[model samples]
Target: MSWFIYALKNYLNFSDRARRKEYWMFFLFYMIFVFVFAFLDTALGKANSMEEALDLEGLFSPIYAIAMLIPSIAVTVRRLHDTNRSGWWILISLVPVIGILVLVFFTVLNSDEGFNRFGRSPKAEPAF
Candidate 1:
């Protein structure tokens, strides 16, 4: 999906606001790809054991996480913006435990009815 491509291309870009379409598109691609790969990997029986399969999975995790970083941050910022909160609040995730949950809650929360400071609105269709 477009979001996946955008995320891969903008892996290092953490600024700017991302609309829901972009964020969800990337999420959709990620889930589908991960699931398909996992299913095939299992069917192939390439690794001798589950642990080996897990180790193999680990090798790609860094790349996958890197691919996901930009959209994650961008979307999170926009979500924060929706709540009339500064994007800087994303930094709160640096805290030990509670911070992670709080930040996740905010980013995963649906956007407000209208725009705040980020942009017009998330309702517009992306130019795919």
Candidate 2:
């Protein structure tokens, strides 16, 4: 999907606004890939137990996760920016359950109309 590729291309860009569709589509595809890799690992006997599966102890899945880690954070930060929140808000997820719930609430919110401070809304059409 274009959205997934867009996120990957901007993998290190944490200073822009990302539309909700972009963020969610990347997330959807990322999870799908993780599952696919995990299945391959199990089929190849790289992961032999439920614990290993849960721990993602496999060649493909772990490698994929490592490769995508920065992109995931970047997109999440950009998603927060779209909502007009500071990227530092991502640290809120460090507080366990409440923090994660709060972060989810923030990410699911609609982008601020026009712009507050981060930049133009990703949902806005460019003027010609």
Candidate 3:
């Protein structure tokens, strides 16, 4: 779907809010490609040395970075939705180790009431 492609195009973008569906869908796409590439690399070529396989791992570096970034960004926005704060709160993680852990906890916490500041409540079910 275009959503998945859009996510990939913005792979390196850290800003801009993302809806839950967009995040999950992109993740689904990422996993599919990861499996495909890993399988193809292993099946088509024989890397006799550990170093050779290590080289293949390098090929995955950029994709891995995006895979990791998308979820982080999505979760941050969802967390902000819960607290009624803006997604910018994610920047708190830059504070230090403790901040990172706290943000993680906050993000994983339950979505807040009807709505706060980051638009409608994330938990609200859509009619569609």
Predicted structure with the largest lDDT when compared to the true one: 2
Better of 1 and 2 by TM-score: 2
By TM-score, the better pick of 1 and 3 is 1
The best candidate in terms of TM-score: 2
lDDT of 2 by residue, 46-114 (tens): 998635754779888889998999999999999999998999999999999999999999999999999
How does each model score on TM-score?
0.58, 0.93, 0.50
Give the range where candidate 3 is weakest over 10 consecutive residues by summed lDDT: 46-55
Give every collision pair in model 3: none
Q: For candidate 3, lDDT tens digit of each residue in 1-128?
A: 67676655655544443455655666577667656655555555644333543455534533555555765465456545555567777788888898789776665555556655555663465412
Candidate 1 lDDT tens digits, 1-128: 66667655655544445555666676678767655554555566654444544445543433555655666676666557765678889899999899999986776666666555666555554434
Q: lDDT of model 1 at residue 95?
A: 99
Question: In what order do the candidates fall by TM-score, top score first?
Answer: 2, 1, 3
Model-by-model lDDT, in order? 0.62, 0.89, 0.57
The per-prediction tally of clashing pairs is 0, 0, 0
